[model samples]
Target: MEQIPKIIEKVSPALVSVVLIKPNKEIQEENQEKDGFVELETGSGFFISDSGLIATNRHVVFEVAGDYWVFWNNKKYFAEVLLRDPDNDVAVLKIKNQGKTPFIKLADSTKLQLGESVVAIGNVLGGLQKTVSSGIISGLSREIMAKDESYNKVFELKNMIQTDAAINPGNSGGPLLNLRGEAIGICTATISDYENIGFAIPSLFVSMAVAEIGAKTKK
Candidate 1:
């Protein structure tokens, strides 16, 4: 209805597509003749600050020193990792004065209810940019196991949102928005064994982490 246009208008500019170049660990091991090898990785993120602060999943910025880069609007910009908390799968990145930019406002996840209609925006399969998908909140406060035991704290995120929206591989770190276009969650993971099992990091944590990062950066 009228709400759809309103949300998209406010949120679209805040969404950004990110491409990362990570070193290929396997390639480096196999090709000992070369100093290093790298593989390209891409994902999506949303701007949370007008001064160039971005909120994205830790995995989205995955790299080993000198191997990461970011792209938006077809322009490549080098970025510095400001803060990363693998425990929550969250990271804050800074790019020197890319100029004033539109940003997304975070919603209060505590108010989210099951069955509420929501939208997801991300780059799917690293092919398209600013793709939009919609679905209802299928479940809340869900949990999934982690591949690495050390990351259990992050994998145990609470107040998560589940949706049937088609969240593909490159959708990680994108925003799971309410129909109002406010970010209710950060699209994080999915249960691939079944259909439509996408999960997101609730806005509550994203807000807390981003705030802490901002505070720490001041010192």
Candidate 2:
């Protein structure tokens, strides 16, 4: 409790709501010419670099056709997908900034213990923004199967960090922070039939994704 406020203050500024806007299929089919983007889904992400690089789950921004916009610090900005790792359920996005945006530091997840305290921050249910939840690391190096009925796909998420944090819908892609307010994992999924059993992509994978992005940027 003593560290919650400080963690929120230091990290909330980098957290952003990820909104996916797609063409209204129903409206288009009825009119045959109607055109407008509708809010398809909402998730959470965090800036990982001052240059506007963002870290999120690939599922958050994985629409075949849509526009991705980010709401940060009460301002909305257009974002583009920069890198994606579907197997890991990780994605990186880029936004235009004047090089003044704050970012979250990636912690060494290898140092995390099974009982270490952690916090999760994200938009919940596509409407509740900046919701925070805290818990201790419940498990590590877990293997889970995530099924997407909409896309008829099953993703085998490996080496996940399991926590008791309340990760509701729309919390995907958000950051799971250590007590120091450093991002140690990316909140990725929760079992609907279970309680306090949320999972996160360990920061080690995040570091690998970021490194891949950097390598691509250099080319």
Candidate 3:
């Protein structure tokens, strides 16, 4: 296997931070409100195609109400949802006016074996950019119940890849890359109050969603 640093260097450009920004209302002179951006949430995403197509978890943008943006290479790009998988906790996005772009190749998740080394990369604590963690696949085909940010909705997530990597809420939608630097899963949830317990959605579903989106766009 190549050095982990080398793999990360090649994949960093394709990684993106997904966020929802709310305009702050600041009444300074009782008439004019200052233009300030308050970030609601900062999740993670990655490029999947040359047309600026990005793959991320649906819950990242689920409650944003269309005010989402992607940060890459020190620039922020407005992003629009192209597709959301109804059967899976996945979503695809399109960067407005963006053409060719860097991307990470999706790998087969079905072949992943327990104890295989992996890396997790994404926004940590909704602000720290590109936080990296390494661990082995702790479990697979895990079925767990998760709650949304509002804590009103409880949903079950199935077929998850459990890892020992240090992941948190902000790491949602980030990539779980194999040693080859190919994306094998998308980070979805982490159990707090517990050490090294995180879960990811396998890449099989994500790759299928991307292909389905591409096919729809060509039509």
Candidate 4:
């Protein structure tokens, strides 16, 4: 409705673009070509709380084994991985220097309905930090394959909310939000042959991951 723009504006501040850097490790092997130590891969993420906690895909930051970085509102800051579950492809990152930021609450994925309008926000090409796309719920209760066997569950993610929201390569790990600006899903996957075919990790999964991170942080 008329509240769409308002809701987007409100949540935009919390959405972030996560950049993974694989610092070139020095090697002793011959015929080694050395480029800059930092190589960049882009993805998106969002804030779940005001305490500098953020959620993103584990694959996005996988194998870095070095420094981690994130971008929000065009500013670059260093971050550290608080926890990661290779099985679920989710990771929790913490930024030490981040100031107070707006965050979204997780919505019940079980309640999501088809044809509901939703917005996707992410950094598409590492430069567009908060790009926005729109679509409607396309289906539910779908499954997606993880990149590797580390996620042994086959990820039969229940109550999925599908959309035609123009998600692209860099859109992974971003927010899939309802019209009310609540996060209903985590931008995760898509069909490459089709336009606007996007799938998201249901928000309930995000809630569980965040709760796990919270519990770990408290100890």
Candidate 5:
């Protein structure tokens, strides 16, 4: 769309790269090619609330061991896990005392139509940041199986938003956005062998996660 570039600039500030760090001596031995770099850029995420609540895929933070953090605008912030939805591939994390942060608005996925234009923003392959891909909603209510690398098990994901946007390893948990810059889904998985085929967990799942967190805060 003609207005997509403006939306990208407006929403890019809320995008983040989620990193996982584990204290280990062997980390140096394992990643010699990376020059002793131990941190892993695991996935992408976006701020969903001005208070610093971020929405990402559950599988992104599924590792039980390792501290999670996020980088936005070249600044690092320690992230605290709010919830890892047991039934959905969605999760929420908080950065304390954030004051105010840019966030993307979540949209209703139910109204999404096939052939509608969409965009995917993510850390492509965990290396490229601020990566943007444009596509259209090719399907809806799709069910697919994806391996959760954290558990070495395959699970079926349902009611997913199907898009043609380019997605890679690190794109998981990033936002699948509309031309308005509203997040319509969380970029989740893609078939590597296929072109123009990517799947996202619907934004409703993100909304559910946010609602759960809010419910807990009031308790």
Candidate 6:
């Protein structure tokens, strides 16, 4: 396996914290004020292109009624939602790029093998940024029914990459990378009642989404 330090150095810059801000009506009413907003959610993401395209989980940005922001390299920037695939739980964001931004390469997820070494990097618990965890691919093509209590809906995620890596609440939308520092999946969810069983959307679906979005953008 590649040295963890070197892999982190190569891919950490591309990792970003995704923040969702929403109006805090309760707070506004309590303070007898208006225009108050609170952070609704926080997750992780990574830049995929020099053009400032980012890949994350759709659930991270879903049902947010306020502004979206991205933090990276000691800076914060406004982000625009570019694409969302609820079926696959994938979403893409676009941010302003002054120049080229560092990005991680995408691996061919179809070639993934059982028990392969993998690492996950993300903001953990919505506070600890750039947390890293390593594990092996525990399973593949898993079909999971994820229930979102907030929305009162359940989503069926198909062909997911199952890993033993530690994926916490804020780890959603982060990258699940191979030893080569290539993103093989996008960390999406975990069984809240379980341990060391996390799920990610395979990179093949991500690549397809990116290509579909790119094609539409040109039209």
Q: What's model 4's lDDT at 157?
A: 41
Overall lDDT per candidate, in order of appearance:
0.73, 0.85, 0.82, 0.75, 0.84, 0.86
- Per candidate, the number of residue pairs that clash is 0, 0, 0, 0, 0, 0
Candidate 3 ranges beyond 4 A from true positions:
25-37, 124-127
Better of 5 and 6 by lDDT: 6
- Candidate 6 runs further than 4 Å off: 23-37, 124-126
- Model 4, 186-216: lDDT tens digits are 8877765777778887888777887887697
Per-candidate TM vs. native? 0.82, 0.91, 0.87, 0.82, 0.91, 0.90
Instruction: Compose the digit string of candidate 5's lDDT tens values, residues 1-219.
Output: 788788789888898888887655646565643433367647889999899999998888887666887877777788998999846789899888667999999999989999999988875334476778899999999989888776889888889888988877656688999988999999988986899899999999989888888898899
Q: Choose 3 or 5, whichever is better by TM-score.
A: 5
1-219 in candidate 3: lDDT tens per residue?
447788789888898888877666532344432556666667789998878988898888786455788988777888988887644689998897766899989999999999999998875333567778889999999998887664467788889999998776556688899999999999888886889999999999988887887698799
* Total colliding residue pairs, candidate 6: 0
**What's the alpha carbon RMSD for model 3?**
3.2
Report the C-alpha displacement of residue 66, candidate 3, in angstroms: 2.7
Candidate 6: Cα lDDT at 142: 96
- Candidate with top TM-score is 5
- Candidate 1, residues 149-193, lDDT tens digits: the string is 233443455556789876766567888888767888888887757
Q: Output the worst ten-in-a-row residue range by lDDT, candidate 4.
A: 148-157
Instruction: Write candidate 6's Cα lDDT for 1-219 as tens digits.
Output: 458888888898899888887667644555432546665568899998888889999888886555788888788788999888889989989899547888888899999999999999885334577888889999999999998665889979999999999987656789999999999999988988899999989999889989999899899
How well does model 1 score by local distance difference test? 0.73
The alpha-carbon deviation from the true structure for residue 71 of candidate 1, after best TM-score superposition, in angstroms, is 1.5
lDDT of 2 by residue, 62-152 (tens): 8756689888877778898887788898888888964578999999999889999999998533457778899999999999999865588
Error of 2 at 49 (Å): 0.8
| Candidate 6 whole-model C-alpha lDDT, 0 to 1 | 0.86
Predicted structure 2: lDDT: 0.85
